[model samples]
Target chain A: MGAHTMEPASSSWVTLLGDSDRRGGTTAARNTAPKELLWKVTLGDSIRSSPVLAAGVVLVTCRDGHLYAFDARTGRERWSYATPASVHSTPSLSGDLVLFGCDDGAVYAVDRTSGGLRWKAQSEGAIWTSPSVHRGTAYFGTHGGVFNAVDILSGRTQWSRRFDGRIHSSAYATDDRVYFGCSDGCVYALASSTGADAWRYQTGEGVTASPAVKDGLVLVGSEDHVFYALDAGSGAVRWRFQTGLGLASSPAVTAGKVFFGGKDGHVYALAVADGREIWKSPSIRQITAAPLAGASLVCVQGFFGTTQAYDLNTGDTLWTASLGGSLGSTPVITDDTVYLATYPGVIYALR
Target chain B: MNRRTFVYNAALGTLHVGLLGTQLRAFQNTPSAPTLQIDIQAPDLPLSKLAMPGLFPGRVVQASHAGSLLNGRVQQAPVGQMLDQGMRALTGESTSKEAWAKFIEPSDIVALKVNPSGTPTTTTSIPLMREVIRALNAVGVPNRNIIVFDRNSNQMEVLGYHNLLPVGVRVVGLDGDWAIGGRTRPGYDPNVFAEMNCFGERETRSYMGSVVSEASKIINLPCLKEHNASGVTGCLKNLAYGCFNNVARTHRFPKTYTDPAIAVLCTAPPLRAKAVLHIMDGIRAVYHGGPFAWNPDFVWEAKTLLIGTDPVAVDRIELEMVEQKRRDVGAPSLWDRNPQNLGSAADMDRSAQKNRFYREPGHIKTASELGLGRWELEQIELRKLQIS
Candidate 1:
């Protein structure tokens, strides 16, 4: 049986803060030039998870165990909820509820308006991956090595599938299919509704990068040191990119190119058509942060607390900023500003 | 069908979906339970010091004596005899009391820096620490004079040291005082290790220079273990823990030579000379999948004790024992990493091979490069004795 799929829960549109509707569609008015520095927010610890933007609130999870809500424009903290463990998974916003996994071993649903707890379902191990929400069900992976689909309001599980290793990536759902990878060297496409397996692709080693779905293709990186593309429908091999080192970052797909950082120290832009390297940058030592896709820029976070912007057209280095320590958090860009947090507790709103 | 039957059918359909989710959630939340292997061994008898290697290239100082116990039995000798052995190995006829005074005085507050990086379930062995406390008291050191410490309080609590601290001794974890007002300068830093050390340059800007400098003497208590990233986690690893701002840079890349970062960490400011003595806890050892192992069964119960005033002698003994134990266990040596270990052994041999200078421990050799201690191991005398 294939991995199950769930019908869309709410057909009613939920208007969020973005110029485009949710799912990160690009707006025509985005500025392509280098932006200025906006305001900066200092956190108590490093921000390791990506920030999710929705419902006028930018949700960020910090290593200090707090899920912070900030005004997307002003960077003022709206409300913060403390978890029993670190919040390594970026929160998923579904309507008025924010769904995310915490290292505390629980999946939490908090009210979007008040930051109030709705319901929490406990997992066996720490939840380090961001959650993917569809219909009324939320799908996510856990350190316990399970991919789960949970009901939003009732905190009940729709279905779950087990793997031989831990899941470090958020499950990406498209139509009725859910795609995710495990550290056990496999990428799985499951039917979201019934929790049955659809198809699986074996990588050279354990897959730690989150699977990205674009144009019927599922792209992911593996510890075996390669980035792979597979047919979303049949789980057949589409193409593969052999990196000098293991691909630790999730593939960010845009404009027919897949950008990812390899452990061997280089950030490469690969042709999605054949997994051919279009252009590769010098090794950045360790590029683990998944690059953020934008209209004109590819934003990447790297070691020694550096954040850099590159021209999407030429892969030219545009500008760089110092974060003081490591930049583990992925950048979330707005129409006028790019917001990111560093491991040393500093949050920057670059305009 | 009747109207009631139709309503009941619709409700049942909704509940079926709910049931499917409940079952899935249960499966997702359930983790494979850890297989617990618990073994308790009676403390080994008649503890004796290991042989110290002779001179090498580095600046290594020899310890006049070796292991000495405190309040507990060593199975080797009485407290007085152990004191005599340690005294003969050291420079003076100073009693264990005088040695205590010289190492730490009543007014001098001492920091017993303990390496808690191994498994949280295991520690440096309670009986061994109790013996060190006994020795301190024998030397006229007060109960409150010594503070046992690590970087994280939660781990210390997991190891059951928090409740044990108030009993006339101080036990502190570096994270205990994480708040703004509670934080002390040069002690705890959250921002030190944000970058990679690939080019092998400086990685940190500010460090905890205060907490370490405030202590009169820092006694290093480390575990004997195998490290995949660094060759060994010994006294140098113990001292480097305080010197570096971040440790994640080493493991962020798999093939990166983390040993250089460790070597540089020992040579850094504040923590190098602060290491006054080296005591290796070899009771419960992890010869595989360490410095932290989830499977506790890998731990071997070896009732052995190693002590020396010279960090080099202490470390050299540990490196050899680690290699010897790996061989005894029928495992490949750490040098098999080939390229990663490319210059690791040669760099170590330069400081530890007993030839031109006194052979030293790797950390002692690195610290000696930073001018911390003598690197010669032969100058160390094995004042081995029975502590029963």
Candidate 2:
């Protein structure tokens, strides 16, 4: 088996959007929201992939068909890899390699240190989900509903299974199971070893949000306007919270609170145990990206207009940044820095 | 003018249109639709000769080939045969190229409004999409002049339409942000729109998709799916709902203005004038819960294709096919307004069969009365082909 790193980096926030738990959108390493503007840089085009910080380098993909690596401190260009088509898959780190999916229908593994091509595994359709690295394997679902598990080091297919609906949800991997939501309106948990279906829980509309797993529950939001927490083993509904509209954004679980944004333009903080609303913010612009739950603050990247930071406990607005272009990428954060990418290809580092 | 006189003028057409200039874009008829109350208005724009019921009116062609789909994959040669046979039958032209040339020109910018809402299950067939692009190319329309589009860009990408299409063919998504009302919604023309008052909510105007305004002609690619709110979604709903922004407001739970609203939106001059063809993909038909793949149990391999210049006639047939399939499966009719079926369960991501709203399948007949096409069987001709 190829050696891949599953150990967490000391302080770097490496979530494509969320922490390893996924539905928990990066509240692990960061307990504070950065408030200072440290640096910003414009890339070739707009970004859809969230920035992942690893080894003092920020890795992000662009709509211009390029995967770029920048110095975490100065936002300086470190190295870059180019793909044939635009990339929506955020760079996921596994061992010495940085893996991401591309619109060219390939899962690319590039050298993390030099951005050199290690191997590229082609799939049947374009992959929009981030490669979920688990136990020396990279898992992802494609736009065509083809799910593949590739060897992390060799970039060879381990096994593949096709579902009935398209898959936009990135996979959430545990030791024994991998979970993902599908446009077929179902949350699916597959046996990690064999890539076989373990259980499936149906939702009303399509589920594009990636699943977040913690405490034996798989949590995800569906386009049907419901946030569901399902039993990990059997896929039974543990609880569900209804929102005004559907959810394209995933959730962040931290300190027993689940923070999420809704397509209906509201930010919600709920108790993780029973899906009870702790606090719901007033309506704002629509949000399609997951929120970052910190120790005292929760930050949300809006689909347009502004990115706001709210009091984690009270849902009170703390700060708002009205960036010129639209914000779509889910921002990553550290203890004192927030690295966000926006439309028209601009990246901002808040410290 | 009184309502009676207005009705008289509406029947008289363009003559009364100029005289009653203020009400020129007025409601075509006062439909006593039980569930929905709607008033539609548009600017009095000039109608093109190739509008709505273009070239041949009241004619529909159904092409069914059992071989079109082989083991879950759409077979290329068989689908090509289906398109060829359906087009030839619809136009009465010996050659497929000649049939396509009836409406499309080498200079025209053709917009293909494809439904990607229900991917993998009921979305436009990739084979059919490719075939349409090939047919357009054969008609001397270059790939650059072709635009394939849907309502949501995200869904389009998720469905892989952009990657599948030819390089030069433009793929666009008409503005999103259904609930966020503001100038935030781009990709829609502000000037050309259909204004209506349906559920007493604000923002009564629905704008035309910006791509529709730029294109000279549109070839509709609607899937055969039973819509929860509008009954069966075919041509009229495809063009009307697909081309307009903020249209989901027409259906809100217990009721919807989908009937008259759909027909009235079809009468909008800019949209109605440019829609020259309708091709319904029935390869995988969703008979019960749909527009979304709400339930895969309701999906059946219909192996059928429909073609027409008359939306109302084609949709009527599409409606019948969906209803019959529902009946065969012991499912409630799309037109089933039985009070017992309605449920107030907070609409969540639960795909239950509880009839939520009174289904408004009469949109087809309302569209016919709006002069889009023929609705009655006696007024139309259907040519069916069985291809081996």
DockQ of 1: 0.01
Query: What lDDT tens digits, residue by residue, belong to model 1 across residues A1-351?
Result: 001112111211121111111222233223354357677788776566767666455677776788888886788999988876556677767767877788656999888779899999887656867777777788887766777889877899888877766777667876689888876568898998987889998875557777787777888887666788899999998887777655667777767887887655577888878888878877665676677655676767775457776776677787777765343366666565666767666777766
lDDT of 2 by residue, A25-62 (tens): 44334434455888998987668778888767888898
Best by DockQ: 2
lDDT of 2 at A126: 67
- Candidate 1 i-RMS (Å)? 16.9
Those runs of model 2 whose alpha carbons end farther than 4 Å from true positions after fitting are A1-47, A54-351, B1-45, B176-185, B344-353
Q: How many angstroms is residue A180 displaced in model 1 relative to the true structure, after the best TM-score fit?
A: 1.2
i-RMS values of the candidates, in order? 16.9, 10.2
- Model-by-model DockQ, in order: 0.01, 0.05
Q: Write the per-residue lDDT of candidate 2 for residues B1-388, one digit (tens) a residue.
A: 1111112222222212122235544444444422232333444556777898887788999999999866565666899999998999888889999999998999998999999887544788767987999999998998767888877776565454653454456667664321111222347776676655666779977777877766789999999888878888889988889888789998877777676677867877767888999999999988766777545666789999999999998998898888787678676777776777777543311433555688888878877776889999888898999998
Q: Could you give the fnat of all candidates in order?
A: 0.00, 0.00
